[model samples]
Target: SALNLQLMSLTLFDVFGAALGVFVVLTVCKFVEEELSNINMPEMKGKEGRFQYTITDVKITELNLTHADLQFIPEVGLLFDVQNSSITLSFHRRILYWFFYDTGNINASAEGVNINTILNLIRDDDGRLKINNITCDARIDKMKAQFSGTLGRVYDFLASFLTSGMRFLLNQRICPALNHAALVHVNSMLETIPVRTEVDQYIGIDYSLIDDPVVTSRSLDMNFRGMFFDLSHQNDTLVNYAVDPVIREYDRMVYLALSEFFFDSGMFSYFTAGIFQMDIVNEKMPKDLEMLLRTTYFGAIMMLNPALVEAPLSLQLAVNSPPKTSIKTSGATVVMTAIVKVMVLPPGQPPVQLSSMTMVYTHIHTSFFYFFRILLDFFDSNIFKIFSNQSALESLALIPLQAPLKTMLQMSVVPLINNWTKRGVQIPLADGMDFIEEVVEYHNGFIVIGANLHFSKGLREMISVMPPPHMAVYVEPTEALPYDSDITD
Candidate 1:
């Protein structure tokens, strides 16, 4: 009976070992599946009603490829290359019951991995960013996988032989699998990240590449020739007019050079039509001004303020701003100057008009108060002086109006201009790219943004399904091109 019991115990142990092997393999597969499944990218798509870019012809040049964990110098003028790269990875678990001293190890190795790729940036006819002239070669030199435990020395010996066979199978499969995986990622990135964004209903972004991008050992250089458009005034006299030195600086990753922009005079005509107008009527005025309105010297005031009449009075208010715009910038700030006009129209009298130029300076990124906040400053308004010379009564009445009028203009009109500067005109070219830093500038008629795109640190781990032992090697420092200008410090 004891002999039979021992036989049954041995049989049970064998079954358990087999079951444990199955569990280990299944666990590895599940881990990989879970990791890949968690890559949700929908958030990269911009929210509705937010500005989104539809980038076209994004020409990336001179991309540097390196292992996520390794770094070494390369030969001069040679693009960094990977050849016969190898990776070794292992996972271990301990069994503490009947197989108390046993440890399970799952080991994987890859050798002779090689890849070369070249691509061109272009926009399709439909205005989508496209990779053109793509050419790539990927190959796995060798691959091996093994599962080993405390079965016996014989099992370990056999595992090595089986691993060789598995390596061949994996080698045959890894190349296609790797290429497919990379394609999936690239397609996802292009699909979700917009290249052309709407600054507003009336403005749009143009990011077409103006010249071929240059690649060096250290960085890729991209030259862009794009500007903003005012949709409502396409045919204005100065719409297409621009001066020379369109791109004056290229010191950072993003640059902007703006020469001039024209706003149609009619853009502010609503202000001229009495949107800011108020009637001066005796019924609504202070007793002092009301008594003064009844006198001959104040009779003119009665015309403007019909409330002064014995019968119910009728009055009309009209306000306007004539259109001319000039814009300049200094140290993260923009100053804008515009001419404005105000008019008062009585039921039967000629319209009275007053004119002045309103200058506003907006400081970008100047404070810590609001998220992405900007400062607005109104400098030296003498609008009331125009009313002062007309007459004493006119001057007295109009002086009180200036404060409210200034507040209204500052609240309503200045913000629109500020928004135009922040969203419509400024371009954040490097923000969304996975590996990029940018400096932005503006000049004559173009936006000159110098961008640096490279292999970011830890990129290998980000894309790896499991951690592997390897270091990047042969990373070469990039040489500056003849045309390269370090305008940014």
Candidate 2:
């Protein structure tokens, strides 16, 4: 029975080992599930007085580098070990126990290992985990000098590599995902409005004098008389007649249309109007002897009585007068030559008027590099040095190692939200131009269809109390309209 007792003891040890292994696996599974499940996405209300469902709880756990524990290995002169390798990143709160409980059932077969093994499995050849060699002088005097110089180069190279990788991953992947999520959120909010039709109308009226033969002759005579005598009163009368009620009506219509759109859409945004040409043209009068009589008489009298006239007038008269009657006739014919012309009244159709309204949605996101830089700076300080004597080297190497993980985690939520945007949602309230052009322009220079809002101080304050990310609606005429048939119908 002694041999049987020893065998029983060995069997008990095996059972205990198996139980411990199970516990570790269960813990890892639970953590992974919780990290993946707890994401926070914002909810938005539509114009139809309905709510649009978005992923307020967006959890990114798979590649989260923040969960990793760093370690410095002086033997290899490289920081390669990470502990508690699992991390849970989410936009919202999560129930850790429940997630792990279910995960345990699914992944019961695979055994869980230490954090270092997990990281090493995923580490690249040139990654921070790679072994590094350090050479130092045998003499104790030179040991410090050699160690500092060789390790310094290693540290600098590692830092540069990590910084570049982090920047590259964020710019290429994480930023795009964030951009897509924003676009989806905007589009979902836009779908709550009921109307999707874009209407733009232009109206213009022009007025001018009807240049008939009689009117031309009279106008020419008036001009000639005005030159000889003051004609301010006559000029005023001409101006009043040329500008008609019809032109005033055109201007009024334009103003009314703009006002109505603004009032109906509840948009008090400022707009600017510009005019290219506001001009007047009169017909030319046919040759008239009466109109030229003043000029001819003045010329002849000045020439005949040079002693009674000023020197300038005498010279003008001498220059103007001809020697023979035939020559005088020719000169008068040339001077009095005038062609009768009719005024073109803009074809009795309205002139083309162009008006534009710009609607902007100002949304600011934290810079991609800002958060990374903050993390980098924080780790560089002496405070972080207490965590590891060789923290500088570890920090530099870990920077690049964490880049891909950061990028992967940051962008992980994008595809899911993007799909929701493309599916299209409908809003139920009577919508205006603001509802039609649901365009969401991303901060990174991309745009998608969504409702745009320009809010006032009061409205913005009201929205601030509500949960983020809020939407603002602006109404302005645009070429694009929403694809939803219910709103358009």
Candidate 3:
């Protein structure tokens, strides 16, 4: 009986404790709900009349409230504890209010006012705004108003700093490297030379001939002299005689001899035969040669003219002349003698028989010689040494600068701006606190980097609506009211 009584008492005590706990929970929940209701109710008569309220915290038990109650609770805050709660009804009301009330009035009154004007009006004096723009209906306005004051300025500043840094890095490093690569490729192409070749056929001959002696035995001698020769043989008589005719005749013979010697030795004859052969072989050859010679000869001429070679016919005639000689014989014995002569032809002016040939050869040779001379001078001069040193210095400068610049641009500048822009972030006002923490982070502290970015599409849209700097605006803030009626009536 004692054991049963003790067990029954323990059970009753446990049941009472459970009941007390439930009562306390219910009382606390009621108090919290009442407090939230009062805080969320707007004062329609005061200066805060235009302001709305949002609830950030509530117990999970109150999630089943109607749409009217949910309007004052932020969707994120409402769903904090409650699962499967309907937050869509509250969001739709907020969007509807934004379109009908705020947007409609701004559009009707400000004829020329665009999205930018609204943005500017709402922005703080320092150009910072916590909630840039709202896009919800009346039910969600309470949540939107919670962000209205100036709490989001910090995030905006952070995003702007990162974006500016990104742009700076790209300009400093990436652009230069790309430009250098292109320049290097162009220089390499310019330094190379294309190759070409030409072939030509040259023919030459050497000949020797021996003469047979057949008419050596049949020879006779005869002598004759002028009758005036004995009188002219006296020294005084010969001195008195006029010798101008003989002198003139002797000069003519000497001139003839010189001409014959040049022709036989293949000097003038070689040049003449070349022109004749070129004219016969191909009409084009002479014209082309003439044009080349003219161009080259317009400059300076050189010493050696390689183009003037003896023709085959001229060579044959020269060889034949050596063997066949005219001889005067007295009786059976024969007198023999041989005379040999050589002729030289130097490069000359135009209109000369071999002018084109000489000029062409001289010009080509001179150009080659000039080029070699310049090359030698370059190696010998101080300028060449300076150029070599400068080239080395330039390469050294470029190599070190290139890597750092590329790193800063791609890792910091480009990523910061591009990522933030992609995420729809806005530029913060210049209030001296643009640098935000953890906006950008790097891995290996060297190669790869990461960034956190936020973007404002509304801000971008507003900026686009504004006209360029050249345009001016005319407005009067103190204009008289159109309605004179008193509202108290």
lDDT of each: 0.34, 0.20, 0.19
Best by TM-score: 1
How does each model score on TM-score? 0.46, 0.15, 0.13
lDDT per residue as tens, model 2, 94-210: 112222211110000101112221111111121111111222111000001011222233233222222222222222233223222223322333333222121111111111112
* Model 2, runs deviating above 4 Å: 1-154, 196-489
Worst 10 residues of 3 by lDDT: 3-12
**What does the lDDT come to for candidate 3?**
0.19
Q: Could you list the CA RMSD of all candidates, in the order they appear?
A: 22.3, 39.4, 46.4
Candidate 1 per-residue C-alpha lDDT over 1-489 given as tens digits, one digit per residue, 9 for 90 to 100 = 111110000000111123332332233233223332232211111111222212111111111222211111122111212455554544343323333344556565656656443444444443334444434455555645565756534234433343343343333333333333334433333443344455456544444444334433332333333333344543222233333223333333233233332222212322233223445444543444334324433355445656434432222233333333333332222233333433334446565443232322332322111221211222223332224434466556555544554554454454544443343233332223231344444433322333433323222333353322234222222322211122111
- Give the CA lDDT, 0 to 100, for residue 276 in model 1: 32
Q: Report the lDDT tens digits of candidate 3 across residue range 106-220.
A: 0000011011001001212221111222222111111111112223332232222222222222222222322222223212221221111110111111110011111111111
TM-score of 2: 0.15
What is the lDDT ranking, best to worst? 1, 2, 3
Off by over 4 Å in 3: 1-159, 174-179, 195-489
